[model samples]
Target: MYTNSVLQTDYPWTKTPLVASAPMLNIAMAPLAVSVSAAGGLGFLAGGFDVSALESNLEEAVHLIKQSSAPIQETYASTAVLPIGVGFLNWGADLPKSIAAIEKYRPCAAWLFGPRSIPDDLRPWVEQVRAVTEGKTKIWVQVGTVAEAVAVAEALNPDVLVVQGADAGGHGLAQSASVITLVPEVKDVLTTRQVKNDIPLLAAGGIVDGRGMAASLALGASGVAMGTRFLASSEAKIARGYQDEVLRVSDGGSNTSRSKVYDRARGILSWPVQYDGRGVINKSYIDSAEGGMSDEENRALYKEELKKGDLGWGPNGRLTTYAGTGVGLVKTKLPAGEIITNMIQEAKAILQQLKA
Candidate 1:
């Protein structure tokens, strides 16, 4: 099993049972990332499919971190590396710009995901990032299956492995097991293969609160990475209607389904065939899956919805509301820092009670 000590050594200021915000493209921006890190957890800013804004985003994050409290500033005063992390979608990210931003800003971690090909597509990214940062920026790869975990571990040897289950939001493998089975299985396989045991595993998917965090820790994860839970954070770069819908949904298991309908409707077809997104089931999904709505028709409707702004999202709205199965657990919009601290405290209480 993995332990939080591994993460603590890499991120000296982080607290135990590490809570990290998943870099939900465009949503997890500078404020959210900085706030989470300031609260003694890891926060990540999405580098997005395009790397054009990455440098500016990092600059803003740097400014925010400097303006942070004395403790946060002092902790990072000696290191040139930024405390926050940046996540990239390998399939569409421009390698040159991505490498340049990483080289310049040197965020504590670079989370690589959605590669068109395993190991092969990831090698240059891993090598170049390490070379430019001199290992200051840790490599964290998000994998959805045991095969990817093993392959990446054996070949790339990422500093951290984020095991994303099928229940996760945004983009991930269309067919993958839940974190309950995936985390332990990956650990067992890596151990049996004599891979580096010190590499920590971060569980992602359907983890919203302390209960979920405690359960993940018990399942052999050193930490938890939450995307959906952070969607409700006040710092999240989300629209009013989208956030409201995130709070309105319940029984995540029934309300959210994995499909490419939303992506197609939004005109984003660059993702690999095996990958799909999990989001709230809305008219857009229903129209395509059941109503037999043509792709062109759905795309046209989605365009109109975009003009409606906040009104564009909801059960009947045509806009995309990508979220995880644990969306129900996120009821209110709170500061990213509060969410981090509260979850850590809640997890601690639950663990102590369990021991008792």
Candidate 2:
């Protein structure tokens, strides 16, 4: 078989276009997931926030998937095994709720992000879910670096691996390796370790189109997971204003800063020592404190900004706008399915042209 680069190998995954959207709270992640799956890709409903929201989103996502499948529509039936997944913040919010959710939903896959390694307790959680789902469900863990990925892979024994680069939008590894630089390195590491599980390696952060998809796969990634690009889609749950900001921002996007400002104000208890989130630089959030203000001060400023409706100050503004470096590439909001389909088609074209 011909290969472009990165010593391409046939893995368990069929080398398809895979896009995973960040599960936003209150907003429906299911519709977005279903839309992407309907377009012949995968979708994951985010579930790590308030316990209520998590439960609600899971139930609603299942309901939507079932209802949308009514009448044996060819469209729905055609994509029945679209590889839908669900994700949760590993070190944020209530882990119990997330655990219970996996058992209840039994999604095709479960993704966990944050923390360098999967805690001992999480092993049981993973095992329980795997057992409850009768081993049909796969487990995916997201990490920032090659070392972190290896550590988690060894500890968790997840069915798949997701290496999220620093450019990934939302809360990710602070100041870590870029995805372009890390994918092949991680791939080499996995191969060296004598692990032949054929785990699908997913490249995240700053991937938007066929060019990016081809680049990542060529670099030893089995697939690509995109968040920001999908968030701008019509099926996404974000407000129009939020999506507009995402498109307006540049690729670098004013040096995205990660901090605990928003989580504290929202009263969402995240691990103080473990992780922070990256969001766009909002004027009001910057005004709350001098450059050196304490995290608490920033939280107060976030709260104050929440009170003022003007300046577009709110969660969409004061809170971090989770986006990847590819934000610059996102120009318009299209349906999630169209975006996924186009990227896959474009990638195939690029690869075919390269073969010729």
Give the per-residue lDDT of model 2 (tens digit) for 48-93: 6455576676666666666653321342344332245777665554
Please identify model 1 stretches exceeding 4 Å from their true place.
Answer: 1-3
- The best candidate by lDDT is 1
Write candidate 1's Cα lDDT for 176-270 as tens digits: 99999999999899999988875799999999999989999888899999999989998999888999999999999999999999899999999
Evaluated at residue 167, the lDDT of candidate 1 is: 92
Question: Each candidate: RMSD to true structure?
Answer: 1.1, 4.4
Residue-level lDDT for 63 in candidate 2: 61
- Go through the candidates in order and give each one's C-alpha lDDT: 0.91, 0.66
Clash count of each predicted structure: 0, 1
